[model samples]
Target: MKKYFLIIVIFVVISLLGFSIIPKNPFYNINWSIMSALIIGLAMLAFFWNFEKQGVSSKEVALIATMTTLAAVSRVPFAIIMSFQPMTFIVMITGYVFGVQTGFMVGALAALVSNFFLGQGPWTPWQMFCWGMAGVISALLGNKKKEFAFTKFIILAACWGFIHGWTMNLWHWVSFVFPLTLKTFLATYIASFPFDTLHSLGNVIFSLLFGKTFYTILQRFKNKIIVVPLDNNADIV
Candidate 1:
């Protein structure tokens, strides 16, 4: 637990340091976004390792890996449409099914891996953060035994769309805008509103149609993975 706490501390410290240094001389040349992303990714990996120590089964690991891969690959089909992808929906579903930790991993990894095909830059880390947080938020709202509400899912998806756009725009605001005035920040967000809306709508559509399906699938996998103890005398018999 201490190690996990330390990893979180390191992630936060590195993020603040990276952002603080990005616009300054001697550090301006460094890709702070990439650096931050790597740092956070490493921290998440540490958390995942901790999860193993806490008895995360092999099947759970496999499930998360498979889900992350699917989330990344799901973006390929919507490559032409900017920000119109099922990745967010998939990540949220994972969160809803598996809870916050798994959701975050799926979300962060999806962005990192998908960028290999989509291309990575300063935006990669922001994408990871936004998507990862989105999953965490979704899991927070999810119920363990009941089906997640479709209406709530749509609302959350829409909210995350705006959140993602605003967060991504922050990168531009930080990297390009001098002094980082609110006016410039607002301008960037306003300009990207249409794209954000489309992304939100895409999320709503995907969630409405496929969210429950994904959850059901995950539940089945969870059921299969449950360690059913054998009767003590059964083997002897």
Candidate 2:
């Protein structure tokens, strides 16, 4: 745990330092995105090393890798198919079942891979952080199974969407505006309202429709993973 804390601290500090040092929109081409993925993957590899010390199951690792990879690939299809976003739902469901640690990895890795195809930019790290956190948040929420209700899922998805929109807006906030004024921040957040809405709606609908099943499938790979019946058993919890 302490190692995780130190790692997070380093990542945050590096993120801020890189933000100030790297030119605006550093992720403009395919090469840079691939480079970024390589770099981020290295960092993730190290982070996972710590967690694996406690005996990381091969099933969990394989599941995260496969699911996240598929999630990454799905981004382009989502763009071509329904025009919906790629991965917030997938990662969140990942977090819900497999645990937050798994979700974070899934979200971050998915972002890393998607960046390769979508092209990279200064927003790469932030995008990685946002999607990764979706998984983490799912894990955090999932830990408290007592409150796992359908309505709560909507609220959580919307909340994650809002945060993601605002975080993405922060990139613009830094590039376009300076001094981080309240007016600028608030305006940016407000401007993201539409995307935020879709983000949340996507989460709600996806989670309501498939989160449990997806999560159920996700957990099946875990050692002794529990499978819950889909029938309405609100009182079960």
Candidate 3:
């Protein structure tokens, strides 16, 4: 835990460094936040490997790399604000696959790494916290399936996305620009609510399309690691 904490600290420092240099407003920020995460994330990952690259299995390395790449690439359209892609999908998947801690870590780290292109803003930390919560929430929702296969899980992931967006908007309204206020806030929820709905919808659609494939992929390596149990507690398996 201390090690992850240190990584988060480094993540924050890099984020602050980039954020300090950028102009206010999301428009001018770019993805500095994600970029900072890349540097800190790599450094922290290297640090975890003791800068030696020994003992760590190639598969474990591959899993993290795959998750990071998927998360990063999935977010590109979001940065351009061109579509309603829920980056939360990957985050929820991480948590559902590996448990709460891994899920939260991936979500936060992915956002941090992706910040490289988005430009770090005052909202960086909060965004991390918000996305991180999405994973944690998935863990709490457990593996209960109201339907067959992954229908219930997909619903949970979708709901989590809605929750993520609504929470972020509220955060924005309060902390509109870091040291935020109710007055300075744009109160854009009216405008952004549709985006939130789209995000949730996208999560369900995308998860339905890709989750089973990821599940199959995970099964190939399931025995090697401690797989998270989405079992009797749920209606679906």
Candidate 4:
């Protein structure tokens, strides 16, 4: 547990330092997009390294890849919908079923991969972080329950929409918004309210429609991957 907490602290420290240094550094000619990507990539690597130390099975890696692909692909069709997408629901469900580590990987990878079609920018890292947090939040909320709580997840997903948008808005505010103040902060969030609402509504809808199905499917796969040991001295057929 201390190791996990340390990993989280490292991620936070690196992110804060990187973001703070990027805009102010005049000595190096670094592209904001590239620099930001590098920062987020390193932070994500810390988490992945921590996860790797846990001795992941090949089946677990494959499962994570499959879910990441699914989540990424799901976003493509909704690219034109202005913040409305099923990807979050998919990532959240993955996290709820698997655990936080898997959830974060799926969410972060989905953002990185899907941007191939959607266009990558400085926003890419922010998207990765936000979506990754979505997975973490879902896992925490589920609390290792064997059964999916549909109503609870639906509400959480709805709230995550706004949460996600507000978080992304912080990047915009800090990176671009001039004269950062209370008024500007409020304005930024206010301007994003409608889009955030759309995101939230989309999450609620997806959760209502597919949350249970996805949960059951993941749970089944999880059970199949468990390696049960045979009793010692058991007779062979």
lDDT of each: 0.79, 0.71, 0.64, 0.85
Each candidate: RMSD: 4.5, 8.7, 10.0, 4.5
User: Per-residue CA lDDT of candidate 3, range 2-72, in tens?
Assistant: 57756776776667666656788453444434544444445444334442333545666576667766786
Best candidate per lDDT, number? 4
The residue-by-residue lDDT of candidate 2 on 107-152, one tens digit each, is 9889889889888877777678778878888788788574345566
Count backbone overlaps in model 4: 0
lDDT of 2: 0.71
Comparison by TM-score, 1 against 3, better one:
1
Task: Give candidate 2 regions above 4 Å deviation.
Answer: 1-49, 52-54, 80-83, 144-148, 223-237
Tell me the lDDT of model 4 at 215.
85
Which window of 10 residues has the lowest lDDT sum in candidate 2?
27-36
Tell me the TM-score of each prediction against the true structure.
0.79, 0.71, 0.61, 0.83
- Residue 219 in candidate 3, Cα distance off native in Å: 3.2
Higher-lDDT candidate among 3 and 4?
4
**What is the overall TM-score of model 3 with all chains considered together?**
0.61
**Model 3's lDDT to the true fold?**
0.64
Candidate with better lDDT, 2 vs 4: 4
Q: For model 4, how does the per-residue alpha-carbon lDDT over 7-34 read when each residue is reduced to its tens digit? A: 7767766665666656656524444445
